[model samples]
Target: MDLNLRKAILSNISENDHKQLEATIVDAIQDGEEKMLPGLGVLFELIWEQSDDQDKQEMIKSLEQGVQQANTGS
Candidate 1:
């Protein structure tokens, strides 16, 4: 069986407007379930594809800070 998670996730949300998309992301994060990670990764892939170099750098910096904070148990 072939499961195309990314395609499925993208198709499910393809018609979402800005506010709906924001709500979807917030809901997924707040749920904190392992199953939601793939959906989040798909969303992040969309963001990465659309981002400019500066935006990508900023995202990397923010992610680095988040990882550091998590490591410190803060």
Candidate 2:
């Protein structure tokens, strides 16, 4: 079978409103199953693609800080 995971994931929630999207994200995150990662990645990819340079930089900085905090058990 030919399967495009990203395509499937995007299509699944393409019509979501902002609150629906937020609920999806929060639910997936709270569930914390490995399978949810790819869906989150796809959503993040959409965000990154739409973001400007400054926004991208801010995301990178936040991610960096998050990683550092995780590593330190903070």
Candidate 3:
């Protein structure tokens, strides 16, 4: 949440991309209870849309590990 990190994330984005991201984020935040869920939805959609087979495999593996950790009370 640092300013530097925010700037870094925006560094490669176009103006249009920035506008879209800002709108989506603001909408998500205004929803409050489910705030941020939409942003995560967008991220997951992008990952699945753009990732190669190996990338998806790694993502699945990581998620499985996370599930295991959560189930084990970590």
Candidate 3 Cα deviation (angstroms), residue 30: 17
Cα error, candidate 1, residue 73 (Å): 1.1
**Candidate models: Cα lDDT each:** 0.96, 0.97, 0.67
How big is the positional error of residue 43 in model 3, measured in Å on the Cα after superposition? 1.2
In candidate 3, position 61 carries an lDDT of: 99
**Candidate 3 residue lDDT tens string, 4-69:** 633444353335476787676666668775646644565566668899999999999999999999
Scored by lDDT, model 1 comes in at: 0.96
Clash number by candidate, in order: 0, 0, 0
Q: What CA RMSD would you report for each candidate?
A: 0.6, 0.6, 11.2
Off by over 4 Å in 3: 1-33
TM-score of each: 0.97, 0.97, 0.54
Ranking by lDDT: 2, 1, 3
Candidate 2, pairs of clashing residues:
none
Q: Which segments of candidate 2 are over 4 A away from where they belong?
A: none
RMSD of 3: 11.2
